[model samples]
Target: MAGTTEPYDVITMGRTGVDIYPLQTGVSLADVETFGKFLGGSATNVAVAAARLGRRTAVISRTGRDPFGDYVHKALREFGVDDRWVTPVERYPTPVTFCEIFPPDDFPLYFYRRPKAPDLVIQPEELDLDAIRAARVFWITGTGLCEEPSRSATLAALEARAKSGTTVFDLDWRPLFWGGEGGASGAGGATGATAMATARPYYEAALAHTTVAVGNLDEAEVATGLRDPHACARALLDMGVELAVIKQGPRGVLAVHRDGRTAEVPPTPVEVVNGLGAGDAFGGALCHGLLAGRPLEDVMRHANAAGALVAGRLACSSAMPTADELEKFLASR
Candidate 1:
């Protein structure tokens, strides 16, 4: 969204890793014969998505001194994402995620993060404040707030938005990473109540600093303890979000804007393939529209089309469509 003079249009800072998926669907990870690997992590996906949409994008994160890290770099460059800020550390190993595919993506992920991933070590000192402040749009996710230094660093990056830029919070919440009384390892597992209480303060603080908050119904519920879309939007808006959106898969996305305006884009039909990448696609396209300063209705519809294009695709990052592709898809509907 930044003009040609700016170094980047969109910038993202957060966790990134390798995603390994079993090639065969309807099979368990234990039984899968072959697998495919790709660049992943929510923020990384959003970067790739926006880049594919023709925005100059950059990602700020670290990977381990391993082949997986190499793969991540190559994948980002191949997708036109600037990885100049992507670091590689010697002792730590890059995180790897593996999942068994069920039809339409009923995939449960197994994250290999026992020793702590390098991304969790992104200290505040390492950030490029100039790059963060210069971008037209900056995005971060809840997972980045799950740990310490990364959490501090993520908050610091948000500071740039205050100066000039749009800050987007993708509530990429993973209960498994929140580790404690309401964390993944809890005896009976973290309940919705515990999860809500544990996640609220963190979400609230970040939401206070962010301008745009994007999440699905469950994510909104976890962050605000509200299931009703309207209440959820109000709570987020109360936290100072200029715009709050709830992405309802089959129904549509409900959006509440600052000027007492709201917009909804009903689901666009597509042959469902794997549902893993739609949200990321939505984030990318949404950045495009917002950066263009397009109206809320146009923005919502454009974002819906972007996600719909990926819903029926085979992979994640590569599934994101270009601007021309998105417009064509929308024209069809």
Candidate 2:
């Protein structure tokens, strides 16, 4: 479904759903702990953040004709994201993610995603290709590429956008969403090693279309099998991406461009209330900076500040800072 009008400044294509009951500190599946629901999913979070920053943003994805879907729509609207391109399928229920936030320990946090959720059933026909082609930048996430008609649809959209001169941005590599396969969630029965194998092809497909690539330190290690941050960033750049940003969390961010320039941006120190959506905030701000023609160094700095701000907050979308707030933070630094 191609849109009839010309492209926007930025349009995001990927999954959309709800995150039900994210556990608070010390919460686990065994004992009762406080939980809070937030509009989750990587692509949606970035879209909301970009829109709130006053960008003309649109989202292309599928959701179920259920309460969760309605909530997703309402949240996007409230954040000023254009939802005209979002499709609602009545056959399936919307997807939900349940995660357990453990007490502060040396171990990493754990997450559990539901299988074969509605957001995973997106087909090529469900997308509004015209709108995708009309955008100056098309942003996507690795989680959405972990499944079927949606996977093919995502590739198609990227190809179309590329031909139209739209910059294609990819947040590479999420192993959990890939299921057991090496591709998107691996074959349904996949588990352990088998699932990881199933998700590989989809990852390759995504990498082929990526113009700007972003990932955290662990993801960079997984994606390129390289421990050195600079080498990992260079590997992505060699894969034909114009820019590569490796988010090092508390350590900050490192960016490399095809023009042989590199920038290291330090993270802003803040007490982290919740670490969710920080990557999405960084992605959105990075896109905004690039689209506005800011220098790569400044873009990395802005993105670093945005990510730090989001990480210090408890809510996902609500944690995103306003333009004025972002400016204030920048000035104070």
Candidate 3:
């Protein structure tokens, strides 16, 4: 556990679990014989990614009281992320995600979080208010707002932080987690607007306490009811964020600052292995660049490059580039 006197570089809240990925690419889960287990979850991966980049990071979440939960802790420690705040929930077994890797485009995820996920049971009273507020960067995700005590806890942390240092709201829109049209399958069953309508208000509430808002076009629309990159950024700014980052998959990222400065960087080319972890990589790098007070354009470019590096790899948390690796990758590009 880190001492209270020294603030961590990054503190991320929400979601922690194990990911069971098929080692064989392009094979269905039904036929896959071997698998690899790693620490998984959006917020958890973000913390690990930051830690990999030499940031002093911790994750505030919960896991089940099972072997899988033990792996979660071991993984966090190995990744250099403080696991002090990640407790165990006795009621639910740890969540596990199965992914079918298809290489370039399609990697379908199957979430086994039925009944309830331990992370979603986070209580507001369990939060360390001072730690959240004191961190250089506090990262929270949209999924944190999808359920009960966690939703209130997430908001409570955001409110306590009060935009201190750098508060990031990652619009991690997982419809399956929301009990919406997507259910458990990879296929889409409804329009984005339908899910957006249910989640926009909560997203807006979180944005009120965030300094930076990041998401793709689909998530942006879910947060602001806007699809246009410029309009979405404008809406996020109006909601109290100082910066808005719109990640347009193929087109790269668009970052808009309230000071009227804007940077639209093109995507770094890579032969993508699993794309799911790219966003988390981008997020960790974004926090790194922002804490260093880099210019908006440089930050976006650095984040883009970091994301590209992860996309070229298979694992999410383990593939996060170290500071040396990131610099080399950027230089080579």
Give the Å shift of residue 37 in candidate 2: 2.8
Question: TM per model?
Answer: 0.93, 0.88, 0.96
lDDT of each: 0.84, 0.72, 0.90
lDDT of 3 at 18: 92
Full-model lDDT, candidate 3: 0.90
How would you encode candidate 1's per-residue C-alpha lDDT over 1-333 as one tens digit per residue? Answer: 112346589999887889887778888988999988888888899999899888999998999988899999999999999988889878788888887667664767788865677888788888877778778898989988877778899888887557367889999878777764212445223554565566678888888889899999889987888889989999999988999989988889999998898998898889777778789999999999999999998999999888988887767888899999998899998
Q: What is the C-alpha RMSD of each candidate to the true structure, in Å?
A: 2.9, 3.1, 2.3
Residue 170, candidate 3: C-alpha displacement in angstroms: 0.2
Residues 209-268, candidate 2, lDDT per residue (tens digit)?
777878886666555657688998988777778888898866788999889888998888
Most accurate candidate by TM-score:
3
- Tell me the lDDT of model 3 at 160: 92
Question: Residue 195's C-alpha lDDT in candidate 1?
Answer: 52
Using TM-score as the measure, what is the rank order of every candidate, best first? 3, 1, 2
The TM-score of candidate 2 is 0.88
